[model samples]
Target chain A: MITHRVSLFVAVVIACAFLLFDRAEATIFERARQAAADALSPVFEVVSGPVSAVRDFLADIQGYLAVHEENARLRMENAELLAAQAQARDLRRRNERFAALLNVQVDPTIEYATGRVVADDGGPFRRTLVVNVGNNDGIGRGQAVVDEHGLVGRIVGTGGHSARILLVTDLNSRVPVYVEPGRRRAILSGDNSDMLRLEYLESDDGLLPGYEVVTTGEGGLIPPGIPVGIVAGELNGIWRVRSQTSFDSIDFVRVLRFDFPQQIEIPPPSLPGQFIGVEVTPSDSEIITTPPATTDDEPARNESDDTNVAQPPSEEG
Target chain B: MEAGYRRGLGSRIARGPAIMVPVLVTLLCVVATVMPYGSLQGIPLAPMFPLAAIYFFVLTRPTLMTPLGIFAIGLTQDLITGGPIGLWILVYEAAFVVTSMQRVFFVGRPAGEAWLGFIFVVSLSAAIIWSLASMFYQTAIPLVPIIGQMMVTALVYPLLAWVFTFVLPEREGGA
Candidate 1:
């Protein structure tokens, strides 16, 4: 008798779930569900705060203490970089002049909307992030996100005040990437790992395990040449692109206000509203100097008053 | 407060709101505290609190452990952790079903037996969850870390079970 009842109940649930799946979005039930989600999300955030604080305290304490050592190492590396910069500078000048000679008018001019990562959507199945900048910040759907390291992901959905970025390790994520220096094309697919698989590549490309992959700029989802990672160890002879940007524990990020088919509008200054405060640092060189501290009570950023005097007019060389 | 307090003496975990509520809150808090999210590089210790709670409740009072209630709790986990919407629901159902079936075996057994059962159940549940997630993701994700999580969960079962033992102090005529 119990078995019979259980089967019937299971059958009903399966039927209902199937119906829900078929309708997809725009259904009354879906709206109600999303509405409930929207309402409850803030409450969830409140509950998650203690955990976040503890995590932040641990990650930051050790990280900040070691920053001085990292800085010294970086400074020494920067000195070496300065010496090499002269050689790279000449090469860039020649490359730029050559590009000018070629009349490279149609280069993929990147227009980026800088934003800060507010929350880490760190579960196993879903690897995403909540950026402070959103629709109000001219953050639209399908904009490519990149960090200093390389390609993070593209925007899947946007709230009014914030947007959710689907990282390269998410199940739903896919980017058309090319094995660079080889000109071989393949789709970089996410399967909930730090490394993403390179799928659907032509066999003739002679792809190796350690080949570098980058966005092909094919679907306009991502700009080309944003370093996707080196090909990690292959599985069943299929290579995967390990993303350069470890969005693993990143606390801040930038979202590019990119659009395709020409005419891209980078977000203007003063884009942020009162809801989310993002530190729009003008340069990367100053993050170590000070990127203001944010508490749970208030979001962090360098106060405009303190930072305004630094850059008025540059001494044009 | 009630739950933690009652398990020590002549009180019933089921009858005391103090014990039950605190247990629920503690379960939630413990799960929240050391949650492993993100990629495999830094998965937290996974002795899942809800799994422990569900086991205790079903073993003690099956009526108290409602499917919809468990489903709702799992929903909260999914939303907060940014997992697939129905993923935890399926996982909870699987766990619930197994516990419901095996609950009879746990009655009259000492706390240690329950703890062992919990470890076994948690490992089984983690395996199912890992497999289901892998299937949904369409890849053979590594089992090493997942195995580690399950092992951690099993090891932590006794502590959490001890906490549960307080809330639902199993005794004759307690129900």
Candidate 2:
């Protein structure tokens, strides 16, 4: 009895020490976590195989039960989409022309690697998933993960054969987004709930329920224009976003492989007085014109020229 | 003399299963709890099967499950769930200590009394885990999911305890 009590006390003390002392940013702990995930991912895959099959079977039965209503809904949606598709084609042409004229730099095409979700966080407080693709498949930290519906989450950790994704609904997740109709920028913050809280919006003007929200790509890590969710409603005087991605139905996901463009430096042109060894000899019949300078205009002209010449370096810096 | 020898051999044979069954069952429960059951994903929580198993074995065969063994089980769960390292460990150990201290009150009582005792154990374990997790994340986590999980585990305890009884050795004068 005495030994049992001693053992319990020792275990409790050690556990407390680990909780208090172990930092989340420690590389050793991260490596160990990834190693464990790598070792256990296959076991999760095997266990989840039968469970996934059963779930799919039940889903198929539900689909069959609702086939008639689903068909009617699809037919109406198809008609609407066909009309929208034509309008979209015209808009695409106009957008391309405008972009070419403006010389706007557009994002490159996104490439992705697909993987299966092998495990869930299983606990109530955290929302995460372990997928079977990892660094070997070009999955890296901060890459955006999406299902067919919309943006699901982003990769946070990876091993050789598996990776962990922090879902957008987790308390730690914060995504910069633009609310449409007014393009009001806000931070989509998760509160470990089904819906996300829209924080940091500057104004509520022109913002309404069901307004579309998309990523602004403010952070180059996530590319712009990915469909995230819509403004669902307000709760406790705070706006919320309901994610387009359904958590329960997520199985396979695509991890986007994108790299932000780097800035290139341009050398500045030499000032007129700094030119080396260029003697200007006018031809006998050629006339060189010089403007009649006014005392009031001379300094202003020189200052404006200097300002124009100095703008690039400061902007680049 | 031959009959006495046979009785001694039979007692020795019973000892191995008596110890191994509970541990194996508890480990199985740990794995099952962590498996991705998509159907249950909508519920926002999974039943704490390992906690229920530990509670049962600690009540029936307290010597079989040591603190170290319980610690390992908790660590496995924490690692698999990708939560804080020692979160479940502290929660499970606290429940074990409390249950062990109070085992005498429910040992020879009716199944109803044991079931009632288990409700208290599950509630205590959930509260400890909820508090620790909230502190770990530096936020007050929503109470609905943990409360829902507590109710689910308590409600499911009787069924699990019944299944466990099939593996347990019968008492000399059975309750």
Candidate 3:
């Protein structure tokens, strides 16, 4: 009877594991995962501080020694930036009004919480970071994270004082984006590299290299128009976005304080019963454009459909 | 007599579950999980605790790595990796099965043999994971990184094995 019970126990464990894998619904395990993260994140926070301090101490030493050359370079760049800022101010007045006329609600005000990157997942299989800002600092999950250049990632997990930023290179990273005025829709998926792969592009979208990719704000997860990356490479029919933010070079990061416009309606969360589409909810006050759905008989809208469609202003709050 | 008792207790303490496996596996996972820029960092280091533990068990005490333990480790990797659900569990299960069959080769084998066996295991482990992941995602994964990581895992294998020897007897049960 004991042997039989052990057999039953093993069988039950395996059965529960395999049976619990309901593809469509959120797994019982997802809750467990969140709980586990909550429990362990505190410990992780404690553990990571010393590691980050060591890195910072070393980096400071390096930066201190290179200060002169760096200062000279920064001076030259500052002058150029000043000149550009003047030019941008002139253009902004004309563009802002034109944007206003177009009823384009470009993101006007953005607040940021500067956070030091405490820990990084530098493994072969995953890429992520623990940032110092969390719920206490008003950092919300799904906020856009950026550095000096542009898009870094979206925050996925939040703790009391620290949050995990899922970088663009993580395997699970995906953002909805529309190519400039034409608004070609594609999913940007991260595959553990500096370059994110643009998957599920419509055939004949004419996505030439060097075209800019921006958030479409279709999903309230990210706002539109914060520079993402240029279409860096198209090899073997695969297009990749060379992220504007140097993911590898991130030291300190800023979490944008933006809320999803609560206007966009989303599908209600259904219990995990069977296979279901991920519930895509548009945060209200978020107006987003979508490509017309494809039908079998309809030839997909040509590339011209996306051409001349001006992108909306998007920056993570 | 006291010294003899102390030695016995010391070995027992060394073999304690709370001290050994968790330390090894968690250290590896934590380091690997927090490893930023594995591809860009020319250091060629990827945390290899899972490989390390599997090798230690397969070579020393195959029974230690039960299916449930392997499953748990794989599940941990899945959660940490943020990949599709059943991925790492399946790969780990496959590794566990393969390791069981190859247990004899390492018995009385030199450290070099153990090293070779680890290279074999880590290579096979990487290949299985890479190929299965491609099938799952239906996308071509860059094989070079996996291969590169596997080599690093192999290089680090000896040191970890050396560490394990301080606890797990070089000759099984010799303690």
Candidate 4:
């Protein structure tokens, strides 16, 4: 009996060590698991269909129950949205004109494939969801997944017809983000809670509550300017982000396709015409520092401010 | 080919439910854990169907619920749930090992005793799972959902036991 107990103990310890050591994200076991999941996805889809349908039916009934209040809210929102749309069109036109004046190439277009959420890891340990689109639909690992509101997560594993999305609320998620109005950079990390924590901020610089946070694309993984969340609150020096996307009722999601540029180096000037007061790198094209150094500290600060406001239309070699 | 022999073969075939019931119930429990149930809409409401089923079989039909079968069920769950491979295997095996050791104590016990035993075993199982998961993720997962899962499993244990026994009766000549 003692030997049997010792053997079981040894077996469990060995299993734990094996799993801990086999920590590679992409492994043969993971591939086999993905294949198994792909094979069983049809069953999951069939099962989830009725559940989602019933949820929709219930939601519709609730909508009818609160129809009057909802109509009032929708009408108010529509009026605000109409005004915002006109303002956005004007800004877009201005942006296009500026791009033409600066001889800037068109911004890379973002393409997307839509899919339905079929299942979630129903345990307390992780926040992951399986969507019905996979590599067959241009869904690849590390592609951003978003809902209508904002960024939701990224694809971590892909099968033939299904993919797993590791939600931004998962403990493993880390997104480099830019806090708007101030442009303070920070890392948004999840701890399996409703709110995400802002980490890696420089000392003594704090973000105000409700400040907008968007993806900075510093890692070149997620595209820049995708809205992530707002600073909801802070506790014990950790700022929390209230993600714009609602994970509770996530039914459909869009997988964004963004190809990161290969070469970031700028070639040296070949001619005087190509030489300008600014230099451009493919990785961060928006930022341009003055080519010449000024000994006057005040003037240099002023020029830097001006550079931020209006990117001088100078060609770079 | 004799008439009496043919009659015995037919009787054995008629006892197919007796042979298939435990395995089918266990597999169904595994499937139901990952099934999209509406009541499990929000919050990490893990499906504890397997816990209840395992508890029932461990108490009533220990021989039918072998260690290898338990291990297979746990591994399947881990693979499908997309969690660390050995997590559920460890949890399920711990539960099985503990219960199998105490199976004799549960024999011929009253329903209350069985329920009490389930409560104790599930709490131990939940603690083991919580610690192992926390270790795997390198952070402490919240305890609320694990506690909720344990409570729900314990509350539903009697129902599962009743169903199991009803489906597979304890005849006077039972194994």
Clashing pairs in 1: A113-A257, A122-B38, B2-B18, B2-B19, B3-B18, B3-B19, B7-B166, B36-B44
- For model 4, how many clashes? 0
Better of 3 and 4 by DockQ: 4
Query: Best TM-score goes to which candidate?
Result: 2
Which docking class does model 1 fall in?
incorrect
Model 1 lDDT per residue over A1-32, tens place? 36434743574375346334523432223333
| Over 4 Å off, model 1 | A1-37, A40-91, A102-123, A130-136, A202-212, A232-236, A262-317, B1-47, B78-85, B134-142, B162-175
Order of all candidates by DockQ, from best down to worst? Answer: 2, 4, 3, 1
Candidate 3 lDDT by residue in tens digits, B10-93: 765776673345335533554444533323342224456676776676567654456666666766655544444566666666
In CAPRI terms, model 3 is classed as incorrect
* Candidate 2 runs further than 4 Å off: A23-28, A57-91, A104-106, A263-317, B1-21, B39-42, B165-175
Better of 1 and 4 by DockQ: 4
Among all windows of 10 consecutive residues in model 2 chain A, the one with the lowest summed lDDT is: A294-303
Best candidate according to lDDT: 2
Enumerate the chain B TM-scores of all models: 0.75, 0.83, 0.75, 0.81
Docking class of 4: acceptable
lDDT of 3 by residue, A91-167 (tens): 88999888666764445587889987755644455567777678889987778898888788878767667677878
At residue B42, candidate 3 shows an lDDT of 25
